[model samples]
Target: MNNINKNQLFWASCLALLVTSLSFGIRAGILGKLGTDFQLTTAELGTITATAFWGFPLAVVIGGFIVDVIGMKKLLVMAFLFHLLGIVLTIFAQGYWTLFISTLLIGIANGTVEAACNPLVATIYSDNKTTKLNHFHLWFPGGIFLGTLIVILFNSLGLSWQIQVAVMIIPTLVYGYLFSKLEFPVTERVASGVSTSTMYKSVTSPLFIFMFICMFGTAITELFTGQWIDVLLKNVTDNAILILTLTTGVMVIGRGLAKPVVHRFSPQGVLLISAILSALGLYLLSTLTGNSIFFAAFIFGLGVCYFWPTMLGFVAENIPKSGALGLNLMGGAGMFAVSVYTIFMGGFYDKLILQKLPEGANEVDYLNATPGSEMADALNLAKNAAGPEILQATLIVPIILTIGFLGLVIYMRSKKTNLIISK
Candidate 1:
């Protein structure tokens, strides 16, 4: 295979990353505004966010099929259209359902973007699939960092959050323009002339199952961390923007540096370490108070930084022929799993902490509480009212990490065994 023109691929992927990161950044930046505007509870907000995911699985599936037929340019154009429409809808959105519908449309667009670009990156560098794919994915968090900075500037200038959401249209239009002119690579499955039935058959293998399992744990680890960090910090302290900046900042650095570390350790090894650290970070943050909690969040961000993209890269390296279909299935499955996981977290947090708080427990006092004797009373009060739900939420990261680590070991070993048997 010809070596990919790294410069062109890099720019294209950056544009894709910018759009992806901007979508998430805008959602997170305007979360507070949505809460105030719609009077949404954490649970309600989870529902609204999760609503966007409802379209994701279907879109990825459809996009996979369509991209193989019509090409990435058409699908990307459709994605941009959906994104533009979603932004417009969000600006005029009045209630929970309106927000839900708007997000659903937007999600369809997001899913298509992932379905098209993931395989595009892999095909562009068939020989250096993992390395190039990791580089491609570095932009996810990189974009988040850029978007966070933009949001901060916009907010500082006294712009309305609605205007902030609308401004995302600029990136969408620009990327759409770039994509419109680019000739996309053919779907790997299509080039191989692999029948749909045979493709489905391929995924029934042990490797596919193992990758899918890892994908689940990784998705839960990633989405839960990214989507909830802002809310989690808000619950702890009033400095939402600062805390978010710290969290995303850590993520950006982690992903930016991941290329080398991932090259050294391999994606599976990075994933294993990430799972452990994420669990440790979540447990530490969930139980601690004051600046320590903030510190723990940064740690968690570091742990989670490599997860989603690494998993995508792993699949690209191992299952290259599955093409956009494989990308869609994995992305769809992961997002759908995260949607369910986030809702569970929302309920778990509500039952254990939000609902059970003492009638007059000041959020500020709770945030400022020292870790020693003083925090005991507050922690006890929270525990008593919240039951075991806080513990449940705390276990989320560790449990997922343990599962992913074990799955990775099993997957790698299985691959080795299969190779030996084939020999």
Candidate 2:
């Protein structure tokens, strides 16, 4: 620890996260274009997007097991290879299968970054894991804000979507270079000489199980909504990029100030508050519109900003013996939930559109109602109606999360009190 260049490793990890975030931003930006070019249904598009998440669990869980054996550098190299190949394949993709395979590869790479870096950061900053992790996560939202601006700029300049995707390659290469020669420390579990069986037991503990379930709800609330922002708000707002930028911008600031927040509320307390705020935000998004959407977005962003990092922090602080595997499972579980919700939400949107369509008229008929416009008006109207219904349905997730986190907070407080009394 004394010899390690902590700053370099930390920044390198941030760059890797930036690559992941930029990919997300670019993909969200081009969803409509991809759908139009490929002639896909909403569910099919969601399937493609969801494919990016499928590979995460496979890579992270496996990487977690091997990270101590094969070393973190090997995982970083694997991430780079997959990212490069995935981007190239995505660029050349002409249909569903090709895009799906390409995105799956990128998702694996994204998981690899987290597998390597999350433990890496936690290991280095043992004394300040939560605060440092929160700072580390600032890049996710910050990179998204930058990527959204780039895409919006390219659109204004009549550039292609391919150009927007190409931007990720720069950060990917930069991070790979930064991590090339850095020395990685051993994971906390390994350093502490915790037995493998003990590590495994930590993950299977009751508290871990409870938190794992909550991870699904929090992930669905944040990522599922984030992935669909453009499609959902297209009819209600012409400034989708602006909205995305604003939301992520809020997240960046919120994470930047997370240290003080953590100090005041405690991690579990913050989580409980976040769940309540997220539920409120989703409800407001379902009911509110026009200029009011921005206000609701701000609240929603604030709510989700602390969720991912704080959840990981909880595992790191409380489940120290679970080690990298625990972190890996938490991340993998969250992403897997997002994958399920993406497809489910896509189908839900399609169902709402079908319900809104006039009797005896299918989706094709409504889309082809006017020749030159190419169903633009019809599509807008459908989105406007379907968007609110989707938000309302999604509200169920955070409400569940609120109840779960509330239980956790009470349990943790009682546990702390017991420890103090025993001491």
Candidate 3:
């Protein structure tokens, strides 16, 4: 028998997750810089950023299938190795291809963290999976909060973007060191004696299938928009990362109080309310400008704060038979959906910008737009038209989620008492 320190592992998992989210927040913080430095168009940059999202699913899904066999400890070690290589490569990246490959490696590391930790957190807190998962996932936004501040701090000091990228190495090393010494427990499914064949079949259930598809919507609405949100909110404020900071700050607090929230609303009820708030917040953000967007952002943050973990918890609690594979698959599917939408919508963003420009004009012209210059006028026009339309298009997701979750709430109410997760 192993002497497992549950609290130590939980905090280590949070630190590991912090490294993953730091990459995201730092990447988001530097996206515009990468575009400007590389002379990339919005579409090209989107593809570069989406590299991680795509690679994320690949690792998480594969890791899902083998996490049990290879054990969570080894999987997290793999996360550390990949995280180190990926962060180092990113710090030295010379151009687009290098950036793409490095970001992809980081994405795989991020996926591995989830593959191991989601189940780890759930397994340890077997009695309170949803709240504990929320508590663990709070660091996603929490790390993002720290990441944005890092960007702001580095930018304020006139430090190079490479310096900003290097900051990730610190957390990577910390988590790697912690996990290297910790003892891992068997997964809940393995401990409870769920069979592999049974786990496979659970993934195919109608409820599981439905949740899997819904994962697409939630991921897109959160990750896709969050990736480029600086641009989306630029028309409102020059330093839109502050807006993202504000949103994530609220997420940190809201998720800290999740135990009470989860108990009061039930996971399904919380999801329904969150979907409505997300739709409203996205709509307001699509329309509002100046100071008003702050309130909208708070609503948006509160709305999506619980989405990722709660969805996973719903599956784990309601479909206990599905096991580690199921949880990882759900997380994998969400990232995969974000990967697809980021590229597709990115292309659409470029197309819309193209229509707003003169026949020979390109994004570089817009990027280099100077006050009162022809390209400046064209850039202004595109910002007025294309950007809002992109946000408006994304708004449909949370709106649809509102409808979906409303149905979910009703459906949960109709279920047999034993299947219910409500208070």
Clashes of each: 0, 0, 0
CA deviation > 4 Å runs, candidate 1:
1-6, 193-195, 357-394, 410-423
Winner by TM-score: 2
Model 3 lDDT tens row, 134-228: 99999999988998999999999999889998988988899999999989999999999989999999999999999999999988887887778
Question: Judged by TM-score relative to the true structure, which candidate is superior, 1 or 3?
Answer: 3
User: lDDT order of candidates, best first?
Assistant: 3, 2, 1
Clashing pairs in 3: none
Q: Quick one: ranking by TM-score, best first? A: 2, 3, 1
lDDT of 1 at 398: 58
Among residues 3 or more apart in sequence or in different chains, the pairs in candidate 2 whose N, CA or C atoms overlap within 3 Å are none
**Predicted candidate 1 versus true structure: per-residue lDDT over 156-268, tens digit per residue:** 89988778777778878888887776666676677668787777766676767777766777777666566555566554555555555676678777766766887788778
Flag the better candidate by lDDT, 1 or 3: 3
Q: Give candidate 3 misplaced runs (Cα > 4 Å).
A: 364-373, 417-423
